[model samples]
Each structure stands twice: as C-alpha cells, then as structure tokens.
Target: MNACIVLCLALTAFLANAVAQYETCVADTAIVTGGTPGVTVSIGRDEANEMVQITLVGPSDVWFGHGFDGLVMANNYGFIVDTSGVSERRFGTGYSVPTELATTSIVGTPETSIVGGDRTVVIERPYSATDA
Candidate 1:
C-alpha cells in the first residue's frame, strides 16, 4: 500500500476575509505500485481555485486517478490523467463517466527527462466543509 502524505490548512475565516491571499491547503505525496508500474503521486490544493491538484509521475502509458474515499469501486468521483496529456473528470456507479474539466490550464508539461515521465492534473472543486 502506498503511503499518502496529506497536508491540510484550514482558513475559512481568513479566506472569507482575504480571498486574494491564497494559501497552501493540502499537500500530499505517495508512492504507488500495482498496475502500470509504480508512480509517484503528489497532491495539493490551489487556494485560488479552492481545488485539489494532483501530479502523477510514472511511465508514459500509465493512467492515474483518485477518489474521495478509499473505495476503488464505482459511484466514486475522481480525475484521470492520461499519457496523451489530457485530464478527465470521471464519475459513475460501476464504471467511469469522463468529462473534460478544464482544457486550457489543467495539465502541465510532461517531465520526460525523468525515468518514466510525469503529468500534473489540477482538479477544480470546492474545499471540504469539515476538516477530516
């Protein structure tokens, strides 16, 4: 099992007062191995968009996604980063329903210099109300 490192910053009052001041919310990194080789997953939050950003560094053909809960089944919502440098917002009960989230500034350049290559994906969603 990969160890997920999560860093969360809660500033509801501060954010409400100073939306212009963006701060780091959550930052995490994990080493995942099972399917399609092993990949390093770095997750964080963009205070500006109040969304979670995910970066997957792995083989060129590897696909990566993450859900809210530990459950890997359907009915879960997550994002998929493909080798084609495309990010899809996926959700379903048994399978996956993929939709384009943000086409322009969502995906970052692939780091081909690395052993496998890395892709960054930004997820746009409101921050969780409750601090888990």
Candidate 2:
C-alpha cells in the first residue's frame, strides 16, 4: 500500500511540472549589431505558439537609451534596437505573452536604451503560419 501511494504521488508531481512549462523558446541567432561597437543591438525572434518576443540588450550609457526610444510591437513582425553605451551588448528573446496569429506581415523598427548596468527591452508580436 505504501509503495502504491508513493507511485501516485510521484505521478502527480510529474504532471504538475509538465503543466507549468513556459510556452516560449529562445532563438538560435537573435542578436544583431550595427555600425560602431555599441550603437545598435537587436534580437530577431523568440517564438512560442504564434507569438514572438524580441528584446534589445545593451550597456549603461546615454546613447544606449536614446537608440531604443520609439519601439513597437507588431501583430505580424517588428524589431527593437538599442545602442548607446560603452559595453558591447545584443538584442534577443526575453519572455513572451500569448498572442493571436497574424494575417499579414507587419514591419517596425523602434529603439530604446537602458542606464546603470546592461538592460534588455522586450516586445511580443504575432506571425503568420508560413513565416513561423
């Protein structure tokens, strides 16, 4: 009887962990840089279901925060970029919220910055079936 009870408890724990899994995945090559060393940074796609989360990571400088000011999230596709400080940084996936599937391709290019240590800016967007 004790062995059976233990087995049931183990099964329940496994099921609980499975249910708590996050639906997002980090992209393989999400970071992109621009001219100079710390002028522009971008992250491509961090997808989960039909939603993609992108983030811009950068160092602590005045110029860094200025680059990623007018960032936008698209239902189709978009980008966030940052480049303002001394430290070399990148943009990539952070976390994502759920979103509906996108019908058309949307494009955006917004920039922002972070001071102090390094920072990451995030945006979640949707995509079509083919593009995903």
Give the Cα error of residue 41 in candidate 1, in Å.
2.1
Off by over 4 Å in 2: 1-48, 63-116, 128-132
lDDT of 1 by residue, 46-131 (tens): 56656555555544556666544445535544455565654445355655554444433343443333342554443433454221
TM-score for each candidate, following the candidate numbering = 0.45, 0.31
Residue 20 accuracy (lDDT) in model 2? 24
lDDT of 2 at 101: 29
Cα lDDT for residue 96, candidate 2: 51
lDDT comparing candidate 1 with the true structure: 0.47
Write candidate 2's Cα lDDT for 1-132 as tens digits. Answer: 999999999999999866422344434232334323443333354233454445545554433322222242222233323353122122223445423224423333333345666565544445443433
lDDT of 2: 0.40
Positional deviation of residue 85's Cα in model 1 after best superposition, in angstroms = 2.0
Instruction: Give the Cα lDDT of each candidate.
Output: 0.47, 0.40
